[model samples]
Target: MTGAASISRLVKKSFLGAYLEDALTLFEAGSFLAVIHQPDAYALAGTAGPAAHEDLLQRFADGVIPAPHTRELAVEGVVFGWLVLDTPSHAEASALDFVARSLREIISRELLRRGLGAETLEQYREVALLQRAVGKLNGSLDVYQVAHSLLDECMATSFPADHALVLFLDDASRTYRIVQSAGSRELPYAERIAQSRLFSEVLANACWDDADGEDTLASERMVKGEIVNDLTRDPRWDVDVPEVSRMLIVPLATSRIIHGALVMASGPSSRPFGSGHLKQTTTLATVTGIAMANAHHFHQVQRILMSLIQSIATAIDSRDTLTSGHSQRVARIAHSLARAVSQDRREFPDFAFTEMELQEIFYAGLLHDVGKIGVREEVLTKATRLHPRKLELIGMRLELWGAMHQREWTDLFERLQAINSAYDVSEEDEALLYRLANKSIAIGEATIEVLSADELSEFLTPRGNLNAEEWEEIKRHPAESHRILENIPFTSHFPRILQIIVQHHERLDGSGYPAGLEGDELLLQSRILAVADVYDSLRRDRHYKKALSQEMALAILEQEGRLNKLDARVVRVLTGALESVEHAEAPEPRAFGLGSPVDHP
Candidate 1:
């Protein structure tokens, strides 16, 4: 309700009406009560006995009859109207004075009650605003994003100003940079604000005084915040803008350390910031400081974790001389492919990876072969069908056979050597190996088979260097990789890292090893890693097979995609990315190996 209407209602409910009527009856005097409402007045209550007396009361209310015997009706020394009476005897005058005093006290009490109610309502509003700001500011762990949210909450809530800035302290440079801003004035990106002596003094006073000696006054001033009512006269107004008439500067700090400062300002025409603004700004700045500190600590931990992961991957790669730097290369390629896939709207319209998810993919790529650490060094670096020691033993057995049988086994030995090192053993070579395995040489002391059962099995293998047993051992690395990684805590930020690593060797058609997981069971990150692993393996020369050209390697990948052994969309994305690289004159593809090339004989 309007203020005047509320006051009128209060006056009617008070003793003004009853007291005036009692005075008229007691003294036979004409009396009335009227309330002043700006330029005019109106009678609230009066005597009821005579029409002529009532007519005189109305004329006095209208100012037609002179108010010569008027007593001012006021509360807190401010008059609202008058209590007027016709000439009365001495006894009636004293009674009327007491009634007037009682009426004034009632009006004063009512006004005080109304003010308290308004203040309570304002407190509730402030509480609600603070609750909302807390939620918004604490929602993110990114320091830069939290800074932006801090400024946004300040301008959008009860503490709105004509200008707002969130500045962060650069520890290395010992300077403040405007990280986020909102106002009519355009702020340059990362603009450095000079710290004047007054500005530094206020900041030092507002924050914790870290001196060794105890000073009660300094301790009291710590974290109380600052309010500059007149920027024109204050030396602490370091901002170049002169039009800002007032500012509230609060340090974004926690108990541990100070991160930066928050500055909120008003233009000359805007309302000056007071203690209320300082209280609200300090509350928001405190929440922002805690959030920024958490983000800073989180990023620090991430850097340390990444460094440890890289070292482990390097150790794994270094174990096998032939595949040195393989893990690092796969990580780069997988990260690149993931970026490509994220941008391929037509192929992956609903699949967009966040920065953390992309980091997970990169980490998975780097540590995909961690299980190789558990495998024997010889098996990891084996370049031929048989190990060197076993090959040497076989050659000695052949020489003993040739001497005992009185026949030259020179051509047969050379053919056996060819079969052992060949990328693919022909059917003719397999038959020769079978014949050799069945034969034996007899001597005076003992009888020894020319080729043992295990040797024949490894020599007759049709593809790559590893035989059936070694191939089984090689396949265990994926599950082994999972076993090693599951013990570590990777579920928080990189929840999919373990899954991606274990599934990198899996295929869409259930042809791949370890679990034979098919189709939709695989993650997109796993598919990306699979493509990168195979691509890098094909492009690098291994002990058994020569490196393939970029075109040939891609052709092999496309064939595998058609066979349902790899994700087609991921393959296409890699192809597009490589084409772009070629057009851009990227450096030559480096040599790195994962293992035996995928789908190669």
Candidate 2:
């Protein structure tokens, strides 16, 4: 009765079934290998024999196989599988049946040897599937599916669990409840167990303090046991442990936050699971925990990016006093318009973005004017209608004229004092001198405007007025703004934003300067920014120009959009947002935030 025969084309099944069929066959050594259609699948399961059984049994008894490994049957969700060797009565057996049992022991031990080998392969396959699922868990929506599927696969194929249930720890309920379930009818009790002291203490409350796996699991059994804990502690639990008996619970956490716990269990058919069984189930629970943590981390990454963009916007305010906070206002208005467009059925019926995309857009809007940082303060905050050197030039001429008159005035003062003790220029005389000086300064400035730099230098050398050399300095601010933006960090990652900032002043009719890109050549963001920049500049408070009312600003934008320089859709979005903003700001008798407006469809 050799048991090494092979068969062709065998279908795979629960980890144990395939092993039993493979190890029970008998045949010629080499010929047996080819008998099975898929012999290779179970080729690793060893042949049956008494010696083989004894070897594995000794390995398990001495703890070489380990408690968790010894009870691996429970881990795979197999309700029960007794390792009946030819001879064994320690746990309890009849003395008269010992010899017959010994013969069976040899066969059973050989079966276990075969089964353990097959289990090793099956376990590795299960883990491989889990690793693959982990690699694919990049999106939030897929997380729930992958996690549930991982557990189900392990149960249905490995342990043949008719049902699988996952319970997430609900802090609010102070208990555990089924987040996902697909097994038995009594799964809802998982929620009821949330308030159980044993569950709260071992799995949720204090499992972390214990270092030993056995101690932690033993504590869980007290909470999860059907006869011992459930019968006495949970009167609500059905008298029979039909739905749940052996359970595996593992803590779920990452380096940053402890999200919750994962709970896996087998019903009444699978109670008193050994240590190895508990360990395997806990490992599966850990994988689910990591998937949840990854989703959390993705959101954190989004927050960090948003904060960096806001910091850049703040930098602009600190650098220029007159134009401080210009970028922030743009972000608000642009975001408002973006929301209007995003929510508008006419524009984007199904267009939706994660909060993170909107955050990214907001940062782009705020840093739109960061390039202005490179513009000189004199250029950015030009005090007068003209340039800085304009005023300085006047003072220089006035001083020189006073110097020339000093010598003659000194001689005249001495002579005048000799004739009269106290006589000075009369009010009329002083007024006449001041008038002549200002009149001469005006003539110099006007003439300086028409003169070339070289020609003006000749005039300044003679101590006459040329012109304020500052207006030219102020006009170059746009170029300075471009240079400043060229050096911005993360430009490659956000080039569209950089382009919009630099080309904001460009018009659609090729009337704008710099690159002279016209029409569709400009990005959508640039077109939107162009319209927004113009409107904001006209409506917002500025030192260089009077603030135009919203009505007037809208009129100007309407003309621009009509001419096709700026996008028409953007104009519509802006119009909607502006109205929304006004309504939001209008202290409607009882409102504190934007009013909810639902769509008919």
Candidate 3:
């Protein structure tokens, strides 16, 4: 049979029954039939039964065809066995030859049918396994989880690897770094390679590089549908374990770039892998490359999102010079506090935060005052007694008033000249100006007094320079922030982010703005953000007041906790944590450390 003939499409089991029927017709009065071959071998088709089977088998046992009564079964001039006959008159010699030939066709057809069935079953099984592996790979977006899982599942497929290792490309270094390894527990050298920084060196020696010239066809040979069956006899191969007689190395790559390489090795006891193993492993390598690419892309997108969050925080803080780093400080403080709470697992047993949840808390703290963007710039940056422009206008008006009065009162003129030249005014001039400072000063003085009254009202108001109307405008920020974020697409990835952003200003007591969500109604993230915002604000210099000392800030936080405006346990934990950190040298702010491009195995 040709190679194509080995792949028979005849799967119907009825073919076996038809084959037996055709075989029976080849005999006239055959009493027995005997077919013998290698002992204990499994065959697809065989027959042994009845008087026909017994007497024909006895004739063959006598070591001859028994010419007139028996015929030999031969194919291509080689004896397969014999089909013996026992007839009243021996069948014609020509008829016996035809029978033997016909029986050969039937047996061949049966063998072909069985071979195809087994092949089809194996194909189905492999397909099922591949589907399961692909499903597991697609289930997670985490880089390391997907990498480890893919390596494990690929090992279980068609070829059982004795030892396997997956290397991911470190793009910056232009070298493969082992990211995952398996089945190397008993192999010291392999384990050492997996754990060492020079893992690439050991694996590179076993695998051929693509740079080998096409003239040698080395690349073609490596990619051929068969395992690279030869091993280079390097001194590094002196590992004293079972020798890896066969190895398979396939590139994990798409059309774009070579992402990494997959290396699988089998020891002496394993049957040598062939074309079939190489083909299956090549497919697995392709799937793994796609998965790694996707994971890398996912992490890249997360980094971009984190940068966007920080940028937004920086923008909000930039609106006021005094608050340049306010948002960042709050975010850092909130992150520290959350971590402290998480560490105290005994008191807060259910406390937990996935990376994403922690990110949300930090973002909420950074954006707590995002609504200030909507507040009037005047209100947002309002500082001392008067806006600088209003103060300057008042000063100009006072000078003009003094100049106009200088002409009418000679003594006042002399006083003004003395004030301008010698920085002194006569006693009479000072007394006269004091007596008339409020009632006697004319239009310019009256106008200045009116402006001054407003300034005094603002400066003496205790905290912040906002009037009732301006304070109301400032209060609208939280709601304005909610309105602004509502139109954003944050809900698509994290639906809870918007609610956390809106509730950052909320207090445990019913005193906080937007909505007076009190007590248990508040989310833990929101409470953490609120506490962080208050603490950072207290220790940060603002237009309204000087910055409080760390001790004073902690005291105020404690007082707020006692008043039920903040969680007391959180306050205590955060304060203690801050105290411990204050004495140590703090690191300067830098970009978030997502992770290194290449992880150690």
Candidate 4:
């Protein structure tokens, strides 16, 4: 039954029945009172009425009932039923007319109450749907992720579209492309629609050229969202997806700028899109647009920050010509090694790096040598045990000594040159240097030792060119890097960047400098960086050592692994990765950025 008819029956049974019976009592016996509903012709007979309910309905249907006092029952200009009374005199008829007016007023109030209740329920449903859309969109900061979430929301129960597509604007291209889609329809049709002039005009808030040559401002439709009930008949519908019978178009925008458009379509068998669908989709688009805007701004800031970081790394590497591009190579190698480790689950059962963690590792590798900026250039570039000027002064002193003593000291000068340039000084050479240290020379009334204490200490060095003080300064770089990075704020996003960079030089054994961190005290990211740093350092030539071949470099890394100075699993992974690339049919592996060897030695 219709709601109005049902309300009419309920009022008669609950209140009108008793009033009609009392009104009949005010008249003589055999008085009749009945209510005939308009929708179903249902009759309710009063207790004092002589006619039965079914007979009254039959009489009304047959049009054979006697004419009686009649009052129309209606509410808000909509007729529900009629109240009929048959009495003996004018007094009883007048009293029945008063009763009929009172009954009409009661029915009207009940109908109004029912209408308000339904309106309130619909409002509650709409609020709940909006809350759910906001929750889903707020879960991620990635723009693509937000787009996917938006499509999912459109296909949800509240919106119920057969197909949905989210198109985002590419600022550089000045066109829109579908980023996310749903349902069985192929993407070519939607893609064409996204790039069409209709979507462009909608997003740009410009005039749309109708198929009949009429101009319609698309922005007007976009203000509250648009619904095209029949795509075949709509003048603006150009792209043909056979299954789509109707569609809703809403712009994904905020007050500042429009980012894209959201298009939802229904198939031939599904319900057509309506004004309610347009309202819900529009609200969803607004929430998604705000999320996308925030994500875009965040990524822009991230790009700027990354550019600044790369510039700093370049400056650090440029200080010494031999170490040029060293930081970038280390970063690439470290990132590759981390990826390898993550794939080898058996070896590192508890270790796996997420994409964010891998990025942190790469950044750490780039800034690993940032502390070198604080070191003096002369000390950093030192390649010999003795300074050139010191050697020259010694040569002049020896020449003076030869002239004063009337003897040639050419053999001693030559021996000094050999000792200064040799990679390793033999016992015989050390004894010769000791004897030279004890000798003295007098020139212009000034007596000076043949080798000063500092000079003697530097010349007798057993390995590499750096002296004791210079080596100490070089070792302080990692700590200096830590101090410099400590001043910057990177803890929020890259929480472990400082930890990874400071510990890159550390070893599994306690032989590393600075903190002397060992074994479990180190992070897996730090271990990956350490292996990369050593591998690159071995492959590239420095002032003290010649560049090693790839085979030789891997062998040295393996040896370090065996000695417990590096992570054996990580070293093995790097070895396997390099070997796999070599045997494969792809182009020669350039991922590590390995360049031709330089012969510094």
Relative to the true structure, candidate 2 has a C-alpha RMSD (angstroms) of 38.7
Candidate 2, residue 114: lDDT: 48
Cα lDDT tens digits for candidate 4, 269-387: 77777778877887788678767767453333323333455556666676666787798888888887787788887778787888667767777887798788668988877777898
lDDT of 1 at 82: 55
Ranking by lDDT: 4, 1, 3, 2
Error of 2 at 39 (Å): 99
Q: What is the per-residue lDDT of model 2 for residues 159-179, given as tens digits with 9 covering 90 to 100? A: 424445565556786555566
lDDT of 3 by residue, 508-587 (tens): 88788778889898888888888888887888877767789989999998999999988887888887788653333222
Best by TM-score: 1
Query: What lDDT does each candidate get?
Result: 0.71, 0.46, 0.58, 0.72
Report the lDDT tens digits of candidate 1 across residue range 171-248: 899988777888767644224333554446657776654476643345556555687777669766556655566767
List TM-scores for all candidates, in order.
0.46, 0.33, 0.38, 0.45
**Lowest lDDT block of 10, candidate 4:** 586-595
Worst 10 residues of 1 by lDDT: 592-601
Estimate the lDDT of model 4: 0.72
